[model samples]
Target chain A: AQSVTQLDSQVPVFEEAPVELRCNYSSSVSVYLFWYVQYPNQGLQLLLKYLSGSTLVKGINGFEAEFNKSQTSFHLRKPSVHISDTAEYFCAVSVSGTYKYIFGTGTRLKVLA
Target chain B: GAGVSQSPRYKVAKRGQDVALRCDPISGHVSLFWYQQALGQGPEFLTYFQNEAQLDKSGLPSDRFFAERPEGSVSTLKIQRTQQEDSAVYLCASSFLAGAGELFFGEGSRLTVL
Candidate 1:
């Protein structure tokens, strides 16, 4: 079985400050990791994905995530955040053959102005 | 128009009532998925379809929850005897690749069973 864990439920950060959202997964086999962002009353949008190589993956809105195999973590980061960056972030995991994706509970990022 | 589209943006139903939510995947997308998201929680898988073939439905919570993609492009999720616990945002997503590719999601249909 595969599962994703997002330790933070809510993270408040000031505008123009850096932010990081942590995500950890447990899987016996190799897995693909992804980060998704969902705005208020909107559908989830893919931020970045780690399929094979290049542990560091960049995504839209200046967001990036690094896949750490040893630690089983894929943490998302941003150099600086704006009020518009406030949204719910989700971490998902899936295997190569089985496309079933398991997602973390979520991390609500509140960017203060 | 370019992304996955879902119908009935919001649906409020009394307990035991039946409801149907529809999803129109992006044109040419071969894979479609359904997920249920509770308030302040991540989306949980409900079912999946490749074209018109329903491959996996292991995540469905109960027998009352049923989903079908008759023509391979449009899908409908029918809930029989809706319960209060069924209240959640039902999301529909589609992808061009057969396996796990980038998924395009719809705004989702918010269901509130009272």
Candidate 2:
């Protein structure tokens, strides 16, 4: 079985400040990592994903994540965030050989103006 | 092109009532999935379909919950004897057949059981 863990339940940051949301996973086989963002009343959108290439994966909305295989971590990071960036973020992991994705509880990012 | 779409954005049903939610996947998508998201929680996998065949339904909460993708283009999730715990947002997603593509999601259908 595969599982994801997001260490932070909530993170508050000032506008234009850097932010990081930590995520870790436990899987018996190779995995693919992904970050997704959800705005109010909207469905989740892909933020970024780490499949098999570079460890530093860049995504839409100025977001990125680093895949650390040894640590089993794929933490999402943004250099500078805006108030509009306030949303719920989720970290997910899927086995390399399968399509089943297991998602973390979620981290609420509050970018205060 | 139109993205994954779900109908009946919101549904209110009685405890014993039966309800059905619909999903229309992107044209040509060969993989479809169903998930349940409780308030403030991430979406949890409910079932998965490859083309018109349901390949995985291990995440379904109960036998009362059923899903079908008869023609491989549109899918439906049906719930019978709804319970309060079943009140949640039902999300539908789709991807390419190769199984290495990203999953596109729908806005989801919020079901409220009374």
Of the true interface contacts, each candidate retains a share of 0.69, 0.46
Candidate 1's residue-wise lDDT over A9-98, tens digit each?
999999999999999999999998999999999999999999988999999999999999999999999999999999999999988767
Task: Kindly list the per-residue Cα lDDT of model 2 for residues B51-110, writing each as its tens digit.
Answer: 999999999999999999999889999999999999999999999843457889999999
- Stretch of 10 with least lDDT, candidate 1 chain A: A94-103
What does candidate 1's lDDT look like per residue over B1-114, in tens digits? 788999999999999999999999999998999999999999999999999999999989999999999999999999999999999999999998844598889999999999
At residue A52, give the lDDT of candidate 2.
Answer: 94
TM-score of 2: 0.98
Question: Model 1 chain B, poorest ten-residue lDDT window?
Answer: B95-104
Q: What clash pairs does model 2 have? A: none
Top candidate when judged by TM-score against the true structure: 1
The residue-level lDDT of candidate 1 at A19 comes to: 99
